[model samples]
Target: MWRVWLLLVTLLGAAGAQEGKVGPQKKPSPQNAPSGAPPGAKNPCESPVLDVTPKPPPTAVLDRESASNLARSMSRLLAHQQERSAQDRAGALAPSAAALAKKVIDENNGIHAVGVGLPQINLGLLHFRHHVVIFQNNNTAYLEHYWKALALSWNHTSGVWVPPFLECNPHSTEIWLHGFAIALTVEKQRAVAGIFRPLRLDQCDSMMAKLFGGPHRCDEETTKCVSEEGRGFRRAGYRCECRDGFYNPGAPPSWRGFPGEIVELDPNDVHRCTACPEQCNTCNSAGKCGVQRDPLVRGALLATQAACMLITVMMAAIVFKQRKCKTIASGMWTILETILLGTFLLYSTVVVRFFEPSVEQCLVEPWFRELGFVVCYGAIILKLYRHLIEFRTRKAHRWVVKDVDLLKYLLAMVVAVLCYLAAFTASSLNFIREQYKLVRTEETSSGQLFLACKPLWWDYVTEAGEMLILVFGIHLSYASRNAFTQFQERRFLCAAICVEAIVSGVFYVLRAFYVTTLHPDYMYLAYFVRSQLTSTVVILLIFTPKLWYQHKQVRSLAQEFSCRLPVDAFRAGEAGALTADGDVAELNLADMNPEDIRAELKRLYTQLEVLRNKTLRADNPHISKRRGGRKVAHRRFSLQKKGSREKVRRLVSLP
Candidate 1:
């Protein structure tokens, strides 16, 4: 056995070695033959003369083909070289340059560089020759012009043109200082025009002065300048100009604040800010221009919205639970509510991300927006169905179709159908097709469509209809509550419905008016408070002791009233009772004793017996009437005796 195992192991080892040596199979190489050889020429391994070159073609043909091939090869080689050079250049720039490039690309696929240090007015020109070639087939001229002009003003670059500075020393203080001066000058110009622009002058000078005595002025004009009484650059006929924060000594006295300090443009003069022709605030805002906009702001807003939705959903759940609102039908309502909230959040986020009101403002197509409305409204309709079911049944715990107000429900259904039809009519088949086209063309993983479409009023209308359905349906539910419960239930339901309606209505109206009314910042808090109130109302209505106590009191009162009714009176004037000329005397309880009660009982028993006998006999109506007449005679006698005795007893008691 040992030998057998050893043999097997040895064989396995050998197999593994052979596998390793062989590695993976290699692909076969093409066979080579001498140029101009016959199609069936012998393989080079089989013939010694198989490698000979073919005779050259005629000079003219050879030259033409050679020249063409050479030109094509050179073109390809040069293209590759240029691509590598461009990549290398990009790699060599600071990481900020790449970010700036990406920003430019995002803006318009254009590129420019702004100086980073003091006096950072230097603008680095990007070679547009390559961009021109690359975007020749695309519309890129506008992009180039936009970036060039923006960079020129932003970087405070001198002259209308950008200069190539491949060997420019980025760390040079002189260049930075000059850039700073240019930036200051540009800021001063913008400030005069009422544009709230940031001052980019390096604070290093002041900071360093505090650390180390400020260095001598490096600029030629400022180097020789000293204190006003001292003989320096000013003594030699050189005028000294202070930095942005410092005032010129010889200038007419101005206020003691920083001479060139930039201030925010007042709203009154907002129109004068030339940078933003019609909207000065747009340019002056933090993310508007000359300031870094935090990407995290969008993310944070989205998170806040998500949190708000979560809270709202939780509140809704609490409300439903507290209301003791049960029913298999309500499950659908919960699901629809969840879907609505989720979709709302998703839609809002998408809008924030891709909806650039100024540039790509029209990308969200009308049909897509309409679809969003449909989804929201559909949720509302579902909620309405739940309310209708609950109300019509008059049962909170179980769903019954018969309980719903069929008329109102049918009306709602009709409205819903009409809304759906409207949505269908307004549907953008073309937009959907375009979305499909985008999917096929773009390499994106998100399956969302309508990224590039424009929003329309129809979308808002669909949403409005949906909200109305929900509001009305809730109202119906409140109305269906028992009259006793109506006050509180109606108030609560009305408040909730009103809130939803008002918010939704206002949102639509603002959207219609193109106003930014909804802010993500406030959504969470608003929804949270609303949800809490709704939950509280639901809880109070569902678990209030007053309702239960009232119900019990009502039942007790009914029983007491029923117990007090005269049982004998109900039996009076019947066929079994005394009937003299079809008139019956009233019973006197004063004379009635245990015997009388017994007698009355016996009479009733006897009458019941006679009726049973008659029934068994299958008597016709006349026969039955005769039998009943006999029983009536017996009851009359007994009642007369009882009444007389009762009168005697009453007289005795009175005396």
Candidate 2:
């Protein structure tokens, strides 16, 4: 059985070798396989060996499809990369263009670009790029030549080449950039070596011919050369000095060829110049320049000064002439003088300084002017008090009284004080409280506040008070015109009372209504004008010669009346006329002789003695011997025939 099995295994191994080469299920021979091997290739337990064909390599069509899919993926990646590259290029260019624009703006300071048409050049390329290709087109030549001509012209006129820098261009950026680069190069060359020695006119003409491809022909009459009109290209004019207020547009051309060949031109010389008007100039010469100064302005100033001087001198003269006229009215005049002087000084300062008043300054100026009003009015108040006292006491002759209307005077004084206080309060309240808050919050200063808070109201009040005082004083003056005599005194008193009533009514209306018509402070000019007018009225009323003459006539009449009575009695030869007049008249005993006066006095004494005795008897009626006393008288006569008749009459009446 072993021989048979060995023989079978040998045959099966031979078969497996054949199957391994030709079938898919074949396994490697025992020599090729490692470790454990099947015990026998022809084992009955093993499945039967099957012959299977080997798989073929993939076809060319499948290979072609795979290659196509891979190629499509690669194409998508390349397209994405190209898009990213384009975006990057645009981003980089945008910033570069902006930077170039900013650089041009900075170079030109703040001048705005009116037109632009150019791509910005990258300045950084010069550093990294190994080589640069400078393209020279016809545009470059045109720009270079034009700029050169302008530079030459500028140099000829101003004695310095006005270097051109980057400016807005309507063409392409490349053209402008190239043009500016050339200009910058020329400027740099000038800075290093100074400009090529100024070229003579002939040399400049030759250079222009070469650049413009034509010879330049200058017009002898017009002084302009052949060039395009209405464009920047223009020929240089003859070298000339510019007139006042004018300047040459360019440098002067250098002298060359013929000596003194260059002509001089005046830049400001008018084309058909006419002389300034004679009124404007002092010069009478036909061709001479006239003075431009305004004579009217000077005349106005001079006139103002003259007027001020006249007023001042007149005031001084008045003051000097009326020094002794210290009447209440005269005091007002003095106050007026002071006011005029102060105002003159203030106005003079303003005129000299040419100050223009703002609202605040206006207000303050009035306040300053009002100081005079207060002082003048205060003096008038005092004067009024004196007049009032003189009238009341019948002491009109006493021009100066030690004591006057104390109460009214005190009230006036109080009002004056209140006026000042109110002024101070108003000014302070307006400025410190109202304006100060506004100023502080707004961070402003006091320049205007000082002006706005001017004491106009204070001045108005002062003027009003002064007016009142004047009226009262005038009334008192009228009333006291004949205080020394009863009849004239009564007349004056009545007249004064009437005047006072009228004045009071007028003043009341003015003070209560007119003054309240507007804010007193705001209407300073009006107030000043009104006050002056009122003063004028008062002065006219008080100083009228007619009124003064009438007063004098009344006084004279009173004096005549008082003297006439005594003179009449004396003329009639009436005795005791002097004595009856009063003690004052008796004190004047010089009119009578001592002896005649003594005799007259003695006779008068004897008569007085008799009259005194008769008066004593007349008091006793019982001594008359009436009928009612008859029985008593008979009894008394019988009983005492002796006892006494006188005693009997009295005794009988008693019984």
Candidate 3:
């Protein structure tokens, strides 16, 4: 124990005697060497004093930075620990003490140094090379020897960094300053007090100041300095490791902040770890929440459309074969085909929805979807309206509106829709918006997107327009309710309109909710159902009945009379058979044969003189006595004539 103290104190004395410095001298003085009892001895300390001069000025700044006591704090800690352990062991167990000492030295990586008097500090491990500056405010006022210098007195037995300076015993103020460099004694190992280093920035912290020269800095007050995970350097970094679910994005490495070094940690920041994107709990990077396109449903939509188109084609072919047959009794066969064409367009709209939204898809989808609806529904209304006109007219007039004329009405509706879409498109009223929320993360959510025809500001206008179309369809259905057709087309059309209304209502109510909560796959399913169901209803209820009736060779779907004309009535149009009776013929009100009704009307013309006399007498109040009798006769004749004429005209002008 005495020898251990003697060896360390002798080396420390040699450093000051040789250069009046704090650290070990560069050259050992053989004359100053005390007679050692050991055979093999050599100096392990580097230069006794160090020189460090600041150049240019500290210019570094940080988002969060301030002066700190890392150097003094860490150095005091190491010195206290080492000195205590040294006294505890009394230098008896060399290997164990050496191991303990090395472990303690390695604990402080970003080593800093400062003397009791120096105002400034230096960076790096507390080596003899760095010097503290105690002089007044001047960069070059550093007289290297006047400032506190770190002395490394290498105890050969314990291969570890010891305290900067130590005093063997208590001393007065006079001897304290001189003995501050190093203390020597020829006594057994005993407890020694470390020279007090002021809270002034130590060498490591000053090194930090030098490193903090740019536009970035670390907050040491809130920071923590610790050993780097795998390194032997003292004080690896100043940081607080993020908890389980959080992460520090773009944070500086452990080495950079405490000691001012750069390593990988996001963007090299010095703040506490921020939470990762909410989607990623178990991992790093953005989470997996994203829009998942409903491909399966979209594929089904395409297939359904293709099948419908095929069915539409076949129906068109079958309907074409029955073109001239009034029994299939849709308005004009050509107009009905035009309706089929419209249905084909509607079905095609389903296929177009198979792709994701983009400029082309956005534009094309609305165009196809709305235009198809306009054409199909418009054609239906026009067909009904043409028949409706006949009933809407006064008794004296007949409406034989041409098929092409009815088409013009349909074309006008289509043109109106096209203009509406064009105006919206030109104004760029459409934009992609989140259509459905696919996932919900605490911080951020993900959803599917789509191009709305009109943004929120004007979307109601579009909705209103759509509502009006359905209202008009309902109105048309009602107005034509009493206008009888051979094939109960009114009922089926009303059914189709009802279906569309239901779909529209449901879509309107659920749209807002599903847009935020439904999955994309379900969204596609809703789209397919809404698009196809109306068309399906129209096809199955209206057209399918026609197809079935036409297949069965039935001429008229009208329930009232047998479809065939009586042979007598058929011959009535061929000869003067219809006019054989110059007298008014009794009318069979149930007769659907055109010639039968015409024959009756022609016979009524032959009684025009008699019918006129009765009508005049009945309408004249002056002849009150016989007016009742004449009115009864006139009423009977007038009803017969009107009914006969209506039947004849309707049957003859059916196309």
Candidate 4:
């Protein structure tokens, strides 16, 4: 093996030395000369073209030309047959087998066959191919001289020019593979199949063990890698520098490494490196790469968050103050306030996701969002239930009970929220994968990695939930359409729900096909947070102010009752009136709630009706003819006038 390698190297050296000498120049013919040149002048083409100011050797490739020239030269060194003749055996060796294999595999780095060849040379074949094979053939001298002549023409210094091909006999079986149909002997056949074949396989295994760190590895097979790793081959011009699947994540701008070393190829794992900026896919270490949100998209997301937060705080304050005004916190109406507050908070958080929505955020956001809607809509359903109950009782002329049964409603709301949460969880919301997109601008260039959620279909839960609420609210409104003024509270609730449903439904339909033009958060804000915007308006313009006014009316009614009949004088008036004396008695109406006040009004109306009937009977013509009747008529008129004046005072004092 040593002798064969030494002989090949010595031949290559002699060939290089001979090719370096300049050959005799050719004189140009008169007709072949340039039109402006003198006759018998040497053509400029006679001399080799040279660059006066040649650039330095490029550290990295800028184009395909240099690489292409290198490939062509390498191809010539490892001879590829374009056409095979009938004399050429199917499995045949080329001239200078040992030198050819060494030059093709070692110098070219395992790139053997190229350009749509019938058979691709496996890299593992390098192990067996490099073995020294001694052939007793007459064409041995011719093969050696042919290789020597071809090597002479190769340029070793500049390494940019194409190499010339060497011609060979087509019928030379003595120089081909061990087996041949014509002139090859059986001795050569036995040497190849018996001695060379097994030796080559063993050598191939050994080489694979050295190159891939394992004997079982095949050069054609790909390897596994992590999230930041990859594997590739050299058939595509990658010489273990940065393989095809690998990328350079440049160092941070603060790195003090060599100027061009900000990002360098990994020595171990081809794809593993650290150069990308925080929250970025790839960068030049000088700056981060992030996708900039469009101005309109950014503004909308921020505005929605700010607005929702403000509204949430305002609603909570109003609800708190309303409760402070002697209003029951554990009542059906309080549920609506709770719903408004929950929705506001949910919306505010939803808008924040537009900024940097990660996998964790996407996974958990829907749960809170669905829970908020459930609470709000569930409260509406309970309110409708309470309203219907009251409406039925009042129509039947039965005493209407105003008990809120707050615990029952709250339990029901919790159950509904849990059900929504369960449904959302069952839907299996998740972040599928991250997409690294390159961002380029006049100011900077970078790459951004965006995490998009999977199964975007679950967002319809909100729409379905809201639609159900609206349906029930509309039903309740219809049920109470002809309700008396005493049940006017239903009207405000009906109007509020209608407005909320319409606004939300319109936005929901719009968002069905509306894609974010700049950032994903824009769609998130429009879809998730916009519903709360409608809820806020309903609370501000409809719910809160109306409830505040009702509270004020109740306070005014209580104040007027206290002023008319003081607690200190109530006992004296009651005792005197019962003794049948001519003194008018003020009623004992101390500490009366709104419900008690309504009862008092009903009693007053009954008394006024009785008094009005007696006065009408006393004014009849038959009664006036009798002297006693005329006296009765005067007495009744006096009582009627007093009752009318009392009724007028009470009516004037009502809220």
lDDT of each: 0.34, 0.34, 0.46, 0.42
- Cα lDDT tens digits, model 1, 277-354, are 222222221112211223566556556655655655674565455332222122343443443443444345333443
For candidate 4, lDDT tens digit of each residue in 1-655? 2233234534421211111122222333334544322122244223211222122223213212323333343344334432544124223333333334344335433222111000112110111232332322111222332333222322232222111111121222111111000011121121011100101112122321222222321122222211111221111111112222223345443533221111123233233333344554444434445454566866766686677678677766766675634233424346756667666755645564655555566557766666666666556556656667655633322224343574476667678777766766554532222342212122221234334554345578666866887887788878866654332556666776787778778876775544322345456656555655556555654455556666676667667867866776557645675546443244456555667776665466568978996886675654444432333323533346557888999999999
Across 107-145, the per-residue lDDT of candidate 3 in tens digits comes to 433223222221112111212113322222221111222
- The estimated TM-scores of all candidates read 0.27, 0.25, 0.41, 0.39
Worst 10 residues of 3 by lDDT: 169-178
Runs of candidate 4 with Cα error greater than 4 angstroms are 1-290, 294-333, 393-410, 426-451, 485-487, 516-518, 524-529, 547-655
Clashes of 2: 19
lDDT of 1: 0.34
Superposed by TM-score, candidate 1 places the C-alpha of residue 509 at a distance from the truth, in angstroms, of 1.9
Number of the top TM-score candidate: 3
Cα deviation in Å at residue 456, candidate 4?
3.5
Tens-place lDDT per residue, model 2, 1-655, is 2233223323322211111122212333334332211223232112211122112113223322322332233223323333345335333433342333334334432222201111111111110011111111112211222223223332231222223222111122211111111111121111000111111122123333321223333333323232322222123312223233222233243311111123213333422212333433322213223223334654555465556546555755665565543222323445435434443443333233223234444444444434433433334445444545544562212233443333355446546655665575577557655554311101012111111222344556655655565566566556555444322323332343344335435654564443333332333333333333433333333334333544564456545544654534543335365555443333333464554544454465569878986775575653333432222324433345565888868987994
- Scored against the true structure, residue 649 in model 3 reaches a CA lDDT of 87
Top-lDDT candidate index: 3
